[model samples]
Target: MPAEEGSGIHCRLDELLADRGMTLTELSRRVGVSLVNLSVLKNDRAKAIRFSTLTAVCEVLGCEVGDLLTVARRP
Candidate 1:
């Protein structure tokens, strides 16, 4: 089934960071984003993200946008 708008999107920030042996503070510093703001996105509580932020994060993490956000399929 098709996911409702703004639903079923999952953030993989924590997992990606773990896989890379990186900390939230490190990412915050590298991406030039505040820890609190990155925490919101890390915990999947962010309602939206800016394109600039996304690009910065992807660059720091060496990942594509798809690696950061993914669509979860519902049965």
Candidate 2:
């Protein structure tokens, strides 16, 4: 299903993973996040993210929080 319009924050996980030549499965293993959860974030279906999970992902991807997430404005 498509993400709801202006419903949640945008996650750049797919782009960052591609730029680093990493797959979602690889990231899931490295960051200790479940593939399903990661997929949710990757597809912009997540309503919230834990700080620890965010930190782990950022550490593995060599990116800051801003690099992984962005605010999507409602029209």
Candidate 3:
């Protein structure tokens, strides 16, 4: 079924980082993003993400956009 409108959009950054044995600090440094910004994205508190930011993250993490983000269906 299609996810309902307003359903939560989640980030899998923590899981991806864990799988790669990488830390947020390391990723922040590699992606040239601030820890605060990465933390917001990792915690799914970010309302939007730039394509450049996404591309940088994907390059460092060896993942696609879909691997980093997901939508959680409303219960």
lDDT on C-alpha atoms for all candidate structures: 0.89, 0.90, 0.89
Stretch of 10 with least lDDT, candidate 2: 1-10
**lDDT by residue for model 3 over 13-67, one digit each (tens)?**
9999999999999999999999999998897778789999999999999999999
What C-alpha lDDT does candidate 1 achieve relative to the native structure? 0.89
Clashes of each: 0, 0, 0
lDDT of 2 at 70: 81
Model 2: colliding residue pairs = none
Please rank every candidate by TM-score, starting with the best. 3, 2, 1
The collision pairs in model 3 are none
Q: Which ranges of candidate 1 are over 4 A from the true structure?
A: 1-6
Total backbone clashes of candidate 1, pairs 3 or more residues apart or in separate chains:
0
Clashing pairs in 1: none
Best by lDDT: 2
For residues 1-75, write the lDDT of model 2, one tens digit per residue.
223645657889999999999999999999999999999999988877899999999999999999999876655
Identify the runs in model 3 with alpha carbons over 4 angstroms from their true place: 1-7
